[model samples]
Target: MTQAAYEHNGRSVERAAFYAIACDPRRSIAVEACAGAGKTWMLVSRILRALLEGSLAKDGHGVQAHEILAITFTKKAAGEMRQRLNEWLVEFAQAPPEKLAAELLARGVPPAQIAAQAPALQNLYPQLLASARPVQIRTFHSWFAALLRTAPLAVLQDLGLPANYSLLEDDTEAITAVWARFYATVVDSPSARADFEALVAVHGRFQAHKALGAALNKRVEFVLADAQGVVDASVPPFDAQFPAFAGLAAPEDLLWAQRPLLQEAAGNLGRASAVTFSAAGSALEQALTAHDADAVLAALLTQKGTARKFGEKIVGIATVRAAQELALQVAQAQLQHAAWAHQQRMARLTRVLIAELASLKYERGWVDMNDVERAASVMLSDPVLSGWVQERLDAKVKHLLIDEFQDTSPLQWQALHAWLSGYAGAAGAPSVFIVGDPKQS
Candidate 1:
């Protein structure tokens, strides 16, 4: 049977790959198609090829058949991409297999068997395959989130808790609990106490600082589950594990690719990042630091990248300005939610316990960035969390596929790197496939 040949739009790297792919399929290639180069069209074909080849089948010992993970920059993009893929599948499905076979031969796919699969390609193929078997198609965030949810359930069970215990909704919330427990366990340790004291000195209060700490501990719980009882049981007792937060592989494991960069920027900041500023400084102080016209020029160029390091710095200042804007927005939103909740907690305030929301915010205990950075830093840097996350990645998938490579944060990428390092150390495994648009950077 023949396969479809891509319509050319001059020199698309994706075109080269597409021709080669229609000739023969490979997983590690990047399709560097520019705008109007039919990148999405090619993307649809790649997915179809994967599906026809039984790579989408889940009831296998070899190739994975689970729903292909597709991630795009926006919810709209994802929807459009899914719709297009379905439409193409149906289009191909409606065509006679013999005609498609001739078409494949005329275009490229000479596989005698591939034509047989064409009739199997229905618009409902994804849905039918998913229902009859196990197929899923979801954006990256949604799927990873589901995995994250399952991770903790495995952890709590490993910790020997009652069977009915469930993982929490937010990782930050769970981490707070675990770190509180960790602190309770380690209160007497001389070094731990000294460190705790140092934090109190700088921050004004030493009590109730385990928000993200507990978050990482919750990660530990999941790692233990992956191990099936291999982690050191004596290190600490997790009354509740951080099942949602699987410590990522390692920093370097994340690629400096475009997709990751966008993912991080969008997921973390609603499509904005540190590069949003166009002023000399994110704050007026920065503008004042510059001398004369060069400073003004630099500030003007601050929102974007430049040829020199100075330009980059200027652009970075713009990003800082952008961050400030974002922070203000977040602060405003949080204040409203917290204030309303505070009022409810007080319930017609009058006495001290029932006073205004401000009093309650201070009295009832709350956490912010300080707690998040400190605790997450500890768990991620720890030997146990890093080791366990790497092992799980290596054990779960023979191939590592990461999307939105450019938008991955340094910390998040590091988690994947740690895993890759471990995999390379072990040998006989695939190196991570990092794909994304550098132009998007």
Candidate 2:
């Protein structure tokens, strides 16, 4: 065989071996594969195996159609998976014995057991069609919405949501309206106006609006971070000290005091290393003469705040070396302070924006996907409500297959973890199959 063909066949065999283990119904598994690696095919294969083996079901008579839940990242993916699974079942039911045996073997059933598996494979189509509750294949949002429907009215009231709240698929108009109201309120309130002005001064009006919009889009993440105490709003103080320039309170003052010495050193280095030092020397001279601290630091250090090379000719000059080191330290400290200040501003702005948006949503009786996820998480975590929710979910689903798992948000994972935590090692515990490609994510 050609080398390329041989290598391709080798990979095929390896993937088949992996499928054998990953598709086993008795074991819960997680698989990460690159795009075009047949993740959908593997997911479908696992479902079929679980149904045929019946080991994952509490009743031990094979998993029913209603007992299996498949969650996908997008609606189109969920649709595609459902279509593929149905097509496979139809094909399996009609194929002749030999064809059925080949299909079974290809799906990871042992060759010795293919004949014994044929009857169950043929029966799956009719079984699914007769099921009172068809298998649920839904996007994460869709599944969460369905779960929320089962929540008690008292719980919904606790979440500040109406009994029949409408899902806002597109929240653009609502967000724009909230922003206008927020801007008006900020103008009317002196304290809020000051914060707005500071934010606008740092980022300019357009960028400031854009930053706030981005923060609103990631409100869920901010809420989770705040709850975990991972976000610190206090601005970090710039405390870098330079012993070489002890009395100089500012970088510009230090540069001005050492102007004569720096100019002489730069002149010498420029003459020795014209290609590397000439441009920096000229810029340094101009900045020092201008008495601009930021410009002087930029000339003395690289963009990453590292001191520029001064060449062998100027290395032995102690005073010049100390000045360069001091400039680098000042640049580093200034950068840190600026970053911390920006983060604090963004955090403060985001908090206000989220509050305004929440009020708007509440007033309109609207809930977005983020709200759905949060509500679901709250329901799953509540000590009293969780037991009730678990009982309902346990009766309906015994196997979970999550596709595009890498794209799942932290909040979604938290809810799933809370819901599944108690089932570990318990009687009739559900089996989970997760597959995704991190590279794709």
Candidate 3:
């Protein structure tokens, strides 16, 4: 992990890059790693360099193990990092000199230097382990929870909640109960009852449960902004909605009329139809004799015979053109109505759901994981409290390492950024290292 250990006879571009970042103690580093690129190895190498040589050196003057903060997205990652550091330290310390030399030599260290440095490196065994033990490596949520636990008074005061509030680990049961109660309450009200029934009649199901879950899980709080302009719900006239189909085609201009394919079929009433065995010829014989647009359209749209390639062509070119135009018009009208209905329903339910959840939270004096993050973010928004928290964190942490930076949401970033800014601005600012894949996130 020492800077000198990385000076070797041969090095891959990846290894050189790792050493470059890990060896440099003056500047911050941000890495955008692709999948299976050994992100964990790179991160651990950086941590080790900081511990054995850079900031958290074995010398009494280096930063303490507890001072370096490594934040990742999952508890499993945190455990892996801690385990890796511990194992590497133990392996290098106790292993035979030949074994240690093999490890160092494999890393491109000169053969002569590997044996020479092995003994000195062995001395760092106890120090590295002791230093790593107190190092703060945790998932972002776990870190935030720790922060809140450390200074609950300020966060509680800002949230307008008592200090004794508990975090409801599994909020599904509570949310379900609240949903049931809210539905029952709404159903008893005359206007609400009417709207609820109408929603079910129109959509055939209640979507509020799924909708609320989706909304709550988002990183940013949604503001249900009013529609930018007035919604014109009145159905547009057929001509306005579908200009091509709006103009009625005369019976003679119809595809069947011009082509007279049905007339041909009618001439040979018992001829083999397109499907060979189906009675399409007889059906066409009946429709062609009628010579009505309605009958032609009905036969074109609904008759199974019209589905065949030959049958479709026999429907007449003009008739097919007319049918396509009318079909598009119908489909567009239905789609527009469906979209509008969904938006209106979602808008109405979002407001109701937000209000209900707020009431529930207030009455219960409990919050979920999302609430914890949100509350911490809100508390950090105030300049005074943010400054206080910043000063508190600045006094302890010397380096900040973040993993899965892409998945870090805006709210989480806001809180972390505030502290990062404070740390960056301070004298002898700490190194801020971030690793992530934007594509994966």
> Could you tell me every candidate's TM-score relative to the true structure?
0.39, 0.77, 0.62
Candidate 3 regions with alpha-carbon error over 4 angstroms = 1-14, 22-25, 54-61, 95-124, 128-133, 150-162, 188-195, 206-208, 223-345, 390-395, 422-428
Estimate, for each residue in 1-441, the C-alpha lDDT of model 1 and write its tens digit: 643344333433443444545333344445443456455555555455555555334576433434344444446666776787666655666777676665444333546655555554543455544554332344444533343323334542433333333333233553333444445434755754555555455444533243223323334333333246433332222111222112423111111112233222223322223454322233223333332323322433333423112233332334434433433333333344344433232221111111122122223343222222222333334456545543553334433444445655444455445534554456444323344556775
Runs in model 1 lying further than 4 Å from the true structure: 1-18, 22-26, 55-64, 102-127, 130-135, 153-404, 416-435
lDDT of 3 by residue, 314-383 (tens): 4344444444444334445445545555556555555566557656766787766666676667556555
Q: Give the candidates in order of TM-score, highest first.
A: 2, 3, 1
lDDT of 1 at 312: 35
Q: What is the lDDT of residue 224 in candidate 2?
A: 72
User: Considering lDDT, which of the candidate structures 2 and 3 is the better prediction for this target?
Assistant: 2
On lDDT, the candidate that comes out on top is 2
lDDT-superior candidate, 1 or 2: 2
Better of 2 and 3 by TM-score: 2
Quantify all predictions' global Cα lDDT against the true fold.
0.40, 0.76, 0.59
What lDDT score goes with residue 294 in model 1? 31
